[model samples]
Target: MTSDVRDTAVKDAARHEARLLWAGNRGLFALLAAARHTGPIARVPKLGWVVTDPVLARRVLNDHATFTMDGEGGVGHLWTQLFGPEMAQFFGGARHAEVRTRARDLFTEDGARSLVERSQGPWYAELARRLAGGETIDVADATRVLAGRLVSDLLGLPTDRDDDAFRAVFAAGERLAGLAMGTTASTELDPEVVERAREIVAEITSGVDAAYRAAGAGTILGRCREMDLGLPLARGLATLLAIAGTETGASGTSRTVALLHDTGQQHALLRDPGLMENAVREGLRVSTPAPVIGRHVARDAEVEGQRLRAGERILLLTYLATTGVGPFDIRREYVPETRQLWFGGGRHLCLGAAVARLQITRMLETLHSTGRPYRVVSRRAARRVLVPTYASLRIETHD
Candidate 1:
């Protein structure tokens, strides 16, 4: 077939598969089946277009020469708008490394320690209070509030006092979620979405700008500005941080809670509180908030005897990979010394992974330590949107 015909065929198949995966529960099972039967499945005309075998996943993510994390293939345009033009370019190759390095200091162990001590504690207290009211609460929204508060604290933004700013961030998250789920057309831009996007950008920019101005002249943002990274880069980092920090945490928390309640794993963890850490890791491994990470084929590459041309998009189903879909087994613990790749394999590995772990660990600890018997009142699939996330996790505390 001609390249155009091939491309059209792949696109059509991807759309159908995306709908089934996003619209129903079968997508989850399909992922598991793909992982089990084949090392990697080149699914055409279904919900998941490609299931990256463990080996292939390792190769694609690790071999920067073969695949790039520029987010260029399918949903690149949508991310470009959300992350801004300059930020989008940085996600590609060498530029991505440069920009990622500048912001690395903020996500380091020390940085996370400071954030947890100064910020997370307060956020946790607030969440506990809200739950203490004895009313059934949406865990998803509660988690979002916690994540949002963390972002606000980190950027020195006035989120807690400013409901308008908080709402804007929440709305931007909603729009981005829609785009990620494949439910919304990338070409169709909603003016309201645009306004919300602009609001989030402005709020984040203003927060970082204020931080720069208030710093004793040698802060992180100050150093970036001095290095010629400019305000836009700062803004981009802040924006990216806000989205990544909030949504991932929110989704992970709600899903972990739901999974625990549904599987009766929460009680086990509560019985042995020290196991909370392990449970957190297992939850992440099982549900994997960011289940799908995409890459663009930088050049021609072959996997499992199939050839993929340059510029073709491939998705790494990390969540599926974790569920014993391939060679790796989730039943085994991820010892840093023994495990191959979990937080990603290559240079594009998640920068905020450490902080993310810390936040998740803390949240799980808090939940278990509460000693309140809580059960999932209702658990349902989230609305069709770009990113697949749990729509609501209603829990009722009994004791």
Candidate 2:
């Protein structure tokens, strides 16, 4: 039994991550590979401090006064370049807290479950039916549409369009995120790239104008309007949410499905159905979809005996840090050091963590409801994108 679960056709977690990184962004792949041997906190020549330790990474994330998301290598800097300094306020200032606090109720455990059921329940039922009938399903494609659907539902976009519209929404978000691939040396975009980004953002947010005006208070667009955050900043936030919600969620969900099959843990999971939560957590941990997180040093500070000056950037190798514990195991317990570092740490922790988890959980549950394990028929990795994801993963379940 132990061997049956332990020795299976490996999906190769390391190889999968490496392939995704290499194919999606060679520059980032090279950086992470080179820095693999660095200390928990090592200062590189140009990139400054590179943290491979989850504890230190969380420390940096929690220390907003020292490290910020507003300037230089931080994600906020990218938004400010695209929108304006007003968007920067949402990243580093009190408005960050205000927005998160206001939207807090919408991301709680119950809230996440409710959101998933409201936005994606029907799709799951259909997927289960198909898989149970021994039909091959493209998990990756489904995940992309599912991610888009959830984001659309949250922003109160016109759900009137079919899944293709949301798939395009996901693609637009992908293109916008892809623009950041060349941002290793600098997060500042060239004029042409910025122009392209504007075009993409406009295309994706075409419905935002109407949603902002008519969306209810519970919706994100409506909340932005209620907060009196002008149109430009609201658009920036919407774009951020779209990309953040889609890329990571899709990657994590599909990868988790592949991981469980490759690890041959589906039978163990089948026997002890109570392990569903751990299976989801383990999947997310091993995948660590949003692998590297960047931050700009706002003020001078000494971390792990290394002095970091303001205006420098740090890259936290989140994928390596979290997965370093061991291979994918559905029975694995929560590790204190990692402590959900994949979703990120500190006040800026992903607002969609619950939503992402619920999505993956629902996918696993759908597969479990088939009353048998599934097999991966084939898989393809996504290329030239910001997030490492499966472009396609076809799986079939047996009775």
Candidate 3:
């Protein structure tokens, strides 16, 4: 086939595959099966271009020169806009490393412990109290609220109890998601949405900046300022931290609740409260919140016998990898020591993974300790389009 024909064919296949996977809940499982049996270098037209082998998954993520983080799709554009042009660490090699390193200190074990104590603990307590009040709560909504507050607090942002800031963020996310999934013509900010987004961003930025200004010399934000990272970089980092801190834990927690209620795993969890940690890990392994991650091939390389040229996109079907289709068997125990790629491989792996784990663990422990038997009311479950999430999971709790 001519190069044009080949490119067209690849694009067509990617669109089809993406639709199928998104349409069918079983796409995750299918991708894993393909990866295991096909030996990592499988063509997923649905996702466009490439899926890496297990061995190469590490190399693809780590090697910034040979593989780039910025892919051909509009998603990368949206990310750049949301995080700044220089934030394209996935595509830019050394630059990506530097940015990732600068923010690493915020997500360490000590950082996570402090975050949980100062932020997540109170949020969980509030959620527990609300649940105890006989309200039909959507766990996802609760998670979002808690995450937003925690993120805001961490960045020294003014997390007003007002709903406007939260609404603005949600609206921005919806517009961005639509743009990324090709559901919308453009993510060009609508006038109203743009205004709201700016308001929210300004509020967050000013709050964080003020905190840095007032903080003691040893504070995290204070230190970054002292190092002369500048206001823009500091603000960008704060925004990134807030969004990640809120979304990952919120989504994971809600999904875990949904899975347990759906699969009858809640009783199992209750029987062995000690199993909460394992169950959380299992849920993350099986249904990772951010299921798809991509990298760009920076240089000519051979993966699983397929010769990829520079600038080719390689999409990692992480949702599939988590399902244990090929080499993974979910029925067995998960050994974290051996299975390192769950959070991802190489330099760009999730910095906040430990924090996410702690959040999930605490949430699960609290729920299990309550000793409440809850049934998921399917009718009341709220569906989110962009992230493909459940807005609220209504649990009919029987004490």
How do all models score by TM-score? 0.76, 0.97, 0.76
- TM-score winner among the candidates? 2
Model 3 / residue 223 / CA error / Å: 4.5
Ranking of predictions according to lDDT: 2, 1, 3
Error of 3 at 257 (Å): 0.9
Worst 10 residues of 1 by lDDT: 323-332
Q: RMSD to native for every prediction?
A: 9.2, 1.5, 9.2
Arrange candidates, best TM-score first.
Answer: 2, 1, 3
lDDT, candidate 3, 322-369, per-residue tens: 554322122347654325455776666777788788877777765654
Model 2: number of clashes?
0
The Cα error of candidate 1 at residue 383, in Å, is: 1.2
C-alpha local distance difference test of each model: 0.60, 0.87, 0.58
Candidate number with the higher lDDT (2 or 3): 2
